[model samples]
Target: MPAVTVSDITTLARIPEPAPSAAERGVRSVTEAPTGFEGEGFPVRRAFAGVSHTDLDPFIHLDQMGEVEYAPGEPKGTAWHPHRGFETVTYIIDGTFEHADSHGGGGTITDGDTQWMTAGGGILHIERPPEALVASGGLFHGLQLWVNLPRALKLAPPRYQDLRAAESALLSTPDGGVLLRVIAGEVAGHAGPGATHTPMAMVHATISPGAQLRLPWRRDFNALVYVLSGAGSVGAERRPVRTGQLAVFGPGDVVTVAGAEHQDARHPALDVVVLGGAPIREPIAWGGPFVMNTRAEVLAAFEDFQAGRFGQIPAERVPHGDLGELPTQPA
Candidate 1:
């Protein structure tokens, strides 16, 4: 939960309060994420599970990586994989992850850091914990979101962005009740560092117990609030929510969330990631790892990948067992 912090939150810029006349969004549905294992058997919560594609347009999938404390030799990550027609945003709240792609886009992202990769046309990449971390064993928690690209940009050149925690636009409420890290798009008048193909906003908020956070939201974007830790309520109706739950908000100009008066000792505050994006509204054909507008397109992507169109792994690229032996920090 130490993604970013300040000694005096009041010293940070404050998000302006929404006007009284502004319409407050209502909660459409609250769903709980199911626990599962991903990659090479690392536990994950399917954050977007059971949610309709229409409500998650522009967002294809989300996985809440372990909040678990790993013992020595227990750390795991994904093998080299191919992706196309989408972007993958990996934000680390704790621990470290090393990424290397066939297109020469790779880096190490730690607490509060982010690695954004646009697999516009196609790309091959792998993510795993560094050797030091695997040897020492430690806590690891993070989120990986799959953002769908519009049909027009499906074959665009790939790109990468490494966003450090310091680059996030940090803000607080007038009362210092919450700390918000804007990772992408605009919040109020402040913008995050991520450059996205689709119009979207991503914010990580830490709300003190008994505090309420109300955000001025774009009317055209669909809103969603996913709880990362602790207990809380969402929307103008104040529907009860807790860790591993996601609240989908209806159309409105303001989105509201409030922390419970009390929380479990393990999680002292309410932590949530708020996301919104302009709907793509186009047909979606998603297969394992690839997201395309049509099934035929998805099939073509698999064919191209099998035919070596995605490029080969670099010769110098170390295999998984050796990955930990590499430098933990990005050079």
Candidate 2:
């Protein structure tokens, strides 16, 4: 799970310890993600499954993609689809993904890179592995998060931001026990490169064995911690959590997570993605690929899509698996 790493974590800027008066959040709930298939049959873990909508306000859905190694001709991705009324943030941790959309937002993102697509109003898009990757399969692991837009911004123009791994704000815990990659929003005095429509923070942290990470969190934003791999405990209560489990924290000004003393050989450290966002508190009427403030609006979105109002698919596309010759290894 090499998203981003440094030779010397101590050399990075350190996150300050929380103040004495800061309240430490308690673990509200811990739930395991259910495994499922997505796109064109690639494995995914529904990261936000079984989590309440109210607690997940501003953020609609999340999927931990892959973490699976594929053989040649086994790579897969989503077919052309349409989305509206939200933004999709795809973060690649260990593999490559090709994205193309009708709105001219497309790119190839790999190891630590991010593709932020605002599907406000409406747009057609597609996500797929490149032909080379399909021909010469390798490891693929990533996350795709759906962030909801407020009612006022539902019809905002579509936009895209390609955030490279180098642009991430890398930080370390005060004791240098953990490395944090801030993909979006601000942490302490440092901010990530992602510009979000909603006020939110996304951080991918790797905690060494027996290490702990304490973060000063926003009082207004809700907190959630999802373990990508290994074992850990969350919140001040130290609620035990493991791979594919999500821990939602209760109201507080600080968030805490600690890695267990032991881990399996496959995953030597604890990896987690911490997310928080200010509550939107608006009614959501989500259908298939559209998220709207009302049921009627969601119906209208489907009509528009069927009527060809979302724009047409591009003439050129990233091939799924039509390469003439298969490569012996990933390029």
lDDT for each of the candidates? Answer: 0.91, 0.91
lDDT of 2 by residue, 1-331 (tens): 5868999988999999899999999988999999999977999999999999988888999999989999999999887778889999999999899998888889999999999999999988888889999999999999999999999999999998999999999999988999999999999999999999999999999999999999999999999999999998998778899999999888999999999999999999999999999999999988888899988898888788778788867667644323223121211
Candidate 1 has which clashing residue pairs, if any?
131-324
Q: Candidate 2 — which pairs collide?
A: none
Expressed as tens digits, the lDDT of each residue in 139-204 for candidate 1 is: 999999999999999988989899999999999987899999999999999999999999999999
Model 1: per-residue Cα lDDT at residue 111? 92
In terms of lDDT, model 2 sits at 0.91
Each model's backbone clash number: 1, 0
The TM-score of candidate 2 is 0.95
